[model samples]
Target: MIGVIGIIISLFLLMYLAYRGWSVILIAPVLACLAASFAIFDGGSFHMLATYTEKFMPALAGYIKAYFPMFLLGAVFGKVMDVSGSANAIAEFITTKIGKGKEIWAVVLSCAVITYGGVSLFVAAFAIYPIGAALFREADIPKRILPPAIALGAFTFTMTAIPGTPQIQNAIPMTFFGTDAFAAPILGIVAALIMLFGGMFWLTHVEKKAKAAGEGYGDHKNENLQIMDPQYLPSFVTSITPIIVVIVANFAFSKWILPSFDSSYLETDYDTSFKAVSGTWSLILALILGVALVILFNYKRFDKGVVECLKDGVQGSFLAVMNTASEVGYGNVIKTLAGFSLVAAGMLSISDNPLIGEAISSSVLAGITGSASGGLSIALATFSEQFIARASELGISPEVLHRVASVACGGLDTLPHNGAVITLLNVTGMTHKECYGNIGMCTVVIPAISCVAIIILGSMGIV
Candidate 1:
C-alpha cells in the first residue's frame, strides 16, 4: 500500500515539477529514490543514497549505452537538414504551392513531411516556425494558433501514426515487440489519416472561428523566419532528396541488408538482442544516409562548414537522449518496487484486449512523463515481455501492438510539461495559456481519439 502510494505520489510530483520547468534528469532520480525508499525499506531507514546509486544510475547508463547511436545520428541528420537550408526550402515549397489562403495546410504539411523524415520536433518547429508565422500573417490567421498548426504536422501524426516514420516514438516499440518502424502498415496508415484529416478539420474550424473574430497575425517579431535569405536556399529536389534517401535506405536495410548479416555475437549476458532491435539499426542507417546526402548536396552552401553542423548535432543529441534515458531510469526503479506490480496489474486489467491495455498504459505513462519517446521507452522496457506474452496468447499481432503503443505514446505526451510543447511555444513566442489549448486539441485530443479508432479497427482484424 505504501509502495503504491509512493508510485502515485512520484508520478504527480514529477508531472508538477516538470511543468514548473525542472529538469527531469535531476527530478527523476530524486523522486525515483524516494519511491524506492517507501517500497523497499518499509519503516526501516530509507537508504535513499544507495537506491539512487544502485538502481537509478544503472538504468540511466544502460539506456544511454543501448540508444546513443540512434540519438547521435538522428540529431546530426536533423542538423544537416536545417543547416543546409533544406528544411526551409521544403517548407517554403509546400506553402508556396499551397499558397497564401491555406496557411494551415502549408505549415502542417511542411512540418509533417520534415518530421516524418526523422527531423527532431524542435528542429521541425524551429526550421519552419518563421515560415508558419509568415504564412499565418499573409493569410490573416491568428498567430496564437500557429503552434497547433505547426503541431498538427510535427506532433500529431508524423510523430506516431505514420508508418516507417523514423521518430523515436515509432522505433521504441520495435525492440520490445520484435517489430519495425513500419509495423501494422494498414493500421498505421488509417491512424495517420485520422490524425491528419481529423486534426485538419479541427484546426480549420478554429482558424475560421478566429478569422471570423477578426484576429490577424499578431505583432510578434520572428527573427528566425525574417532573417532567412531566399537566394542561398537549396532547390526543391535537393531539399527533399535526403528525406527520400532516408526512407528508401531504411526500407532496404531493415527488410534486406541487416537481417542477412549474422549478429549471434551480441546475445550473451544481456536481455537485449540486436536481432530484436533491427528497427533501430535500420533507422541509424537511414539517418546516416540522410545526413551524408545533406552534406553532399549542400557542400558549397555550408556557411560555417559541415564540421560545425556535426558538432552541433552531436551536442544537441546529448540532452535530448539523456532526458529520455533518465526517465527510463526512473521508470526502471519504479518497476522494482512492489507497488509497480499492482500498478501494472491494474493497468493491464483495463481490458482483456491486449491492444486496449497497451494503448491505455502507454498513453498514461507518456502523459505523466510529458514525453512520447520517454514514456514509450519506459513502458515498453518494463512491461514488454508481459505485453508480448499476452499478445501471443490472445493471437494478436505484435505489429498491431507496436502501432498502438507508438500512437498512444504520442497522445498525452503533449501535456504542458512536454519538452516539445514548451519549446514550440517558446520558439513561436506564445505562452501555454495562449496557444496550448489549440496545441492540445491537435496533439492530445485528436491523437487520443485517433488511437481509439485504430484500436477499434485493429480489434476488428482490419490489419
Candidate 2:
C-alpha cells in the first residue's frame, strides 16, 4: 500500500519536475530511487543503489544497443541538411512560391517539410526560425505564435504522422511492436490529416484574432541568430532530392528488397523477430541513404569541411541517445518496484483494446519523462509483452500497434517539461508564458485528439 503511494508520488514528481525543467538524467534516477525504496523495503530487499545498477543499467544498455546507430545516423543526416543549406533552400522555395500574404502557413509548412524529411527537431527549428521569423514579421503576425507555428509543423503530426519518417519517436515502437515506420498506413494518414488541418485551423484562427487585436512579432531583433546568405544555397531541386531519396529508398527496401533476404536468422527470440527489426533496418538504411545522397549532391558546398559536421553530429547523437537511455533506465527501475505493478495493471485495464491501452500507457510515460522517445522506450520496455499478448488475442495488427504508440508519444510528451519544447522556445527566442499555450495545443492536444480518432476508426475497422 505504501509502495503504491510512493509510486504515485514519484509519478507526479517526475511530471512536475520535468515540466519545471529538470534534467531527465538527474531527476529520473532520483525519482526512480524514491519509488523503489518503498517497494524494495516492502519486498524485504535493501539493495538501494544496487537496484539502479542491476535493473536500471540493463534497460539503458538494451536501448542503446538497439538504437544508437539510428541516433548517430539521424543526427548526422540532420546536421548535414543544416550545414549544406539543403533544408533552407527547400524552405525558401516553398515560402517564396507561396508569397508573403500567407507567411504563417509558409513558415509552418517549411518546418514541417524539413522535419518530416528527417532533420532533427532542434535543427529544424534552428534552421527554420530565421525564415519563419522573417515571414511572420513581414506578415505582421505575433512572434509568440512562432513557437507554435514551428512546433505545429516540426513537432506535431509529422514527428509521428507520415509513413517512413526517421524520427526516433516513430522508430522506438518498431522494435517493441514488430512493425515498421510505415505501420497502419491508412490510419496514419487519417491521423496525420486530423492533426495537420486541426492545428492549422487553430493557428490560423488565432492569427486572425491576434492580428485584429494588434498583436505583432514585436521588437526582438537582438535575439535573432545570424544565418546563411541565400546565394550559396543549393537549388531547390538538388536540396529536396535527398529527402525524396530517403522516402523512396525506405519504401522500396521495406516493401520489396528486405523480404527477399533470408530473415529466418532473426527468429532467435520472440523479441528479435523479423517484424521487430525490419523497421529498424529499413529506417537505418534509409537514413544512411539520405546522408550519402545529401553529401554526394552537395559535395562542393561542404568546403567548410564534412569531417566537422560528422563530429558535431556524433557528439549530438551521443547526448541525445544517452539522455533517452538514462530515462529508460529510470523507468526500468520503477517497473521492478512493487508499486509499478499497480500502475501497470490499472493502465492495462483502461481498455481491452490493445491499441487504446498502448496509447494511454505511452502517453502517460511520455508526459512523465518529458520526452517522446524516452517515455516511449520506457512504456514499450515495460509493457510490450503484455501488449503483444493482448494484441495477439484481440487479432490486432502489429502495424496498428506501431502507429498508435508512435502517435500517442506525440501527445502529452510535448508538455512544457519536454526537452524539445524548451529547446525550441530558446531557439525561437520565445517564452513559455507567452508562447507555450499555442505550442501545447498544436503538439499535444491536437495530436492526442487525432490519436483517439485513429483508435476509434481502427476499432471500427475503417483504417
lDDT, candidate 1, 1-463, per-residue tens: 8888888889889989988889998999999987887854455446787788888888889889868888888899899888889999999889889876788899899999998888888999988888887777777788888899898899878889888898888887887888878889899998889888988898889888977888877786644556367777899899999999898888888889998998776687555677587888898888988998899889987889888889999999999999999998898888888878888889989788888888888998899888888888888877777888887887778889899999999999999989888888888888999988888988999889889998998777776
Error of 1 at 424 (Å): 0.7
Q: For every model shown, what is its TM-score relative to the native structure?
A: 0.95, 0.95
Candidate 1 TM-score, true structure as reference? 0.95
- What number of backbone clashes does candidate 2 have, counting pairs of residues 3 or more apart or in separate chains? 0
lDDT of 2 by residue, 149-241 (tens): 888889977799788788888888888777777888898899989988999899989989987988887898677466577788899999898
Worst 10 contiguous positions by lDDT, candidate 1: 39-48
Instruction: Kindly report which residue stretches of model 2 are placed more than 4 angstroms away from their true locations once superposed.
Output: 16-22, 40-43, 268-272
How accurate locally, in lDDT, is each candidate? 0.86, 0.85
